[model samples]
Target: MMRRAAFALLAAALLGPLPALAQDAPLRIEITEGVVRPMPVALRFEDAGGAGELLGDITAVIADDLNGTGLFEMTEPESSPATGFDRTVDYIAWKATGTEALVTGQVALEGDSVMLRFRLFDVFAGQPLGDGMQFVSPREGWRRAAHKIADQIYARITGETPYFDSRIAFIGESGPATERVKRVGVMDYDGAGVKWLTSKDDLVLSPRFSPDGQTVLYTSFASGVPQIMSLDVETVTSTALTRDPRAMSFAPRFSPDGKWIAFSRESSGNTDIWIMEVANPSFAKPITLGPAIDTAPSWSPDGRHIVFESDRSGSSQLYVMRADGSEPTRISFGDGGGSYGEPAWSPRGDRIAFTRQTKAGSSIGVMRPDGSGEQLLSEGGRDSGPSWAPNGRVLIFTRLTADDEVPQLHSVDITGRNMRPVALNDAASDPAWGPLLP
Candidate 1:
């Protein structure tokens, strides 16, 4: 059972027309679950002039990215004897340290470019997992090279694609509630390289990345009424996706093919889900029409169905229906009087992440689409808005403070492990994660 919180006031302040988008074909991929943990390895830097100084930093970043997944752990270089692939091995020493896999690399100067060669080894089997590869880049491009190495190792070991090189677009907030300021901000998923995409004057919320990662769809109150707006990520130029006088739109999401935009529109006193072709904003149609409040629409992987939150059943609960707004059915049923809202269907279509309220407090949780196997992942304070990482195993959400301070973004594993705050300086919330960029 979940508890209900006093969310009417907060919901009103955040309600508006859902986000808008440009009509582009959606990017589709096979959604699958990942089960294996990241393999732990030890890296002993091979000295190469000034490049050696960056070894510590580069290895640390790789370790952080892997460990952040609640998978890999790095071995202390001091506790292990020095060994290299080209020389005698120290398998017993590594085995004693509880490391199943190991990585070793050396840097060299190749004219104007730096060359890095790294190898992965299976400690117990005493064999190389893969042939060593070399990366050549400008001396200053060591960071990018390191990330590339990490990505390669991850893909090879996990048998799945890696999202380490992708970026995130979200709302950055600051100031008091009455005088609050907000802007669109972009950063690496691991919380590095933050750049402001929009200036802070107008209030902006729910920044979602386009399929191509070249643009973002979000809600803005710059026009007094919340409207769906799209911004080119590279140029920061923006365009309003919808200009409706009779309704306020919010909670905008892009379809899998990027051909249409799905969002919630408040008409008169009723809020319903609607879709508009990206090529022609005037060609809009309502997908959900009823006496109940229908909001927070997320597309299934195939774009054939949508999962959303509705209160037509006397209390707010999760529901699923066709994209055309037919055959609606309730999927969430559990104990406690609390309700569920803000359901984001996983890109893989296996589960849906959402916010659940219980007598103790609000928390983030996930469940299968059929309304079974519901599990609360985080509890206490105020955790809401669960956005899945490119990989379905991780989720990012907002953790609110007791004083109702603006929420900060935090990430946790689906198993309710490895919870940590994302590295951002300002208050942020309503994160809509984009797919991994090519």
Candidate 2:
């Protein structure tokens, strides 16, 4: 009965208007184009129904997810008040601990399922900021449940879309640079729970996740020549999309609807972009033509257009054309006299990311679709294969160190801040950020 009363009170408090803090502004974080301070938040979870190890694992995953984003620095559990599902949070105590927000939860184990109930509070307002929520899932889905919880908190606090529940497909690299072994692999967005989808016997490149996140499009060299292959992410099975023994196909990418695939087909010493029905490769046809090489096609979020790179203009530059290969127009005009390629359209339809190469240096950069607002994300490196995260706020690409020539996956915020190597289960490149999991 006491637990029921506490929950009711908490819900009622959340529905009521919260008073602004004495400091005049509600304690909230505003993320922008600047160095992140990592807001300090406290986690206070208790195993109400003896959810032993599961509860602890979930707590750790939640913390790690938030920290990985470089947004929130968790307060030491010992320093924060130990509040639980049935107890009211002492906002004063949390404030004293330098925590602006507090999250408390209760985990109950019920047979093969775990139930979690959590609440977030604005410490200074001394009121529940959001309504309490509950999530239940089977034992195998504990990590996903934890990610869902983190996503909710992240969205509530930052007022932005959350990518915590997303996955990444990339080219896993091992062995020496001279004979690097590359395979397609999948992992959680934060680089945990890695699973291989292809073998190292094949040289893999451009591992792109399908729109539904159930399959991936990649190029492999197992047949002595590069060909685009679609791999089922769940079954670990694959089928060749362009199996012409005489032609080499690569740089495969999926349309937003997953009904069609765009790839580069090299035949008779010339390469051009082609779009084919994914279910029936017989419908394959060229979208771009002529003596120039047109490849690395990225679909706009709406799937009406494709942005790619071509060397028809005497140098590698970015271009855009309709999905059906009509009305080709060059978008990039040699940004300060450098070659640009590997263009990736932002998911938000606001920008296109590309690799800038010149005699001076190479870097990863983005620009408006019409070739304006050019911004470089990396200072200097052999950064290539730019792929946008689900939210389009960040990008993951491969960077080859100038000194070692070893390729590694790196992520950079769209604002050109926080360029860093992504933590991975293994060395990786040609990363394709997938949409958020269902």
Candidate 3:
């Protein structure tokens, strides 16, 4: 888990005792299909003490996060009856309005920090969904605290891992198409708190976050050639992981354990998959060597196998092999007459997302590890570079069209519904979703 070393944040029990209730089956919404009716949810957040504008901001973020998922519909807070954090929820009133879940919260401002406490309730069951918890953070970190609250509610209701409190690393592009300037940047998953990690003097591509989310591996042209580099997320410093002058390395990704790095290295004229130890980057070795051009290696969730793009069969396709470069098997058979590349293994270990380019256009699709059950999850115009969320229910990718002709980030559910562009000011590409925060 990734934690903010600079912020003084603490999570503790609520100040007052919470309600105790019946133990019935918890409410859950399994996301298996594309079409889903939004669940009716009522939210009422109170200002505990000295929390004026902060309360509204926090409440808005929580509501937006929940409603944006397309699984939950929030009722107008001003229209709903008021409720206290310590008092019993009005189940009858909420149920009368067809509300299934009710969320109540309180916010207070301390000397230099703010305390946020919240809880969830099953309206029909007349029971508290979970215990109330409080989070204390500096005034500037109120958004982080709000994300935490939203994550808790999401997980408790959906029976899945939360991804609201996560960040994304991407390549920010600007300028004309003939000469564009690119830099590495990081921001909140919803495109807030943008921070640039590199200067625009050199080009950077394929920014991959480490398992711990503290470091980013990317290919840089600072040395006038493509070389793998690692950047510290906190300090904004970078170090070259591969300094070989004879070879060009790119598409770097960390293994599940964070002890090894899988990337593509091209020397002379052939490109192959390579692995290097984080502790000993000076000693790097090739994992796949053949006449075909093999690149863009992605590791399975268990770190036992790797899926990459290869052209050994005379066309670009996806292949899976052991982590040690043995027992190679082709996963994509080109049933659509196009090509595939940039394979990303889902965190759930159930699917592999990839970029499929057919004669019609380009689309983002996914398939089982063995290449069965292939499903295209996007319109075939110009969609590529699919990166799975931490929960594997949604994917973020880049899209381009002739109307705009600029690359931008967009997110879509695995079922190909609710596809929307990410709220970003500049042209962005090569998005990499990090893990949830600690």
Clashes of 1: 21
Name the candidate that leads on TM-score. Answer: 3
**Tens-digit per-residue lDDT, 218-305, candidate 1:** 8989888999998898888999998886789888888888888899999899989999998897899998988899998988889999
CA lDDT for candidate 1? 0.81
Query: RMSD for each model, in Å, please?
Result: 17.6, 8.2, 11.6
Which ten-residue region of model 1 has the weakest summed lDDT? 16-25
Per-residue alpha-carbon lDDT of candidate 2 for residues 1-438, written as tens digits (9 for 90 to 100): 677656656765766534312223446888778755988887777897869998899999899878767778988855657576778777787888878888888888888998888999988888987799999999787888889889889889988788888999888888988889988889888787889998878888888888999999888888988988889888899998878889999988899999999999999999999989988987899988899988889999899999988989998888889898998888888647898898999989999999999776788999998888998888666788888888888899888877777778888889887777878757788889999888
lDDT (Cα, tens digit) per residue for candidate 3, span 241-302: 99988999999999999999999999999999999999999878999998899999999999
Worst 10 residues of 3 by lDDT: 15-24
TM-scores of the models, in the order given: 0.85, 0.87, 0.91
Q: Rate the local accuracy (lDDT) of all candidates.
A: 0.81, 0.85, 0.90
Ranking by lDDT: 3, 2, 1
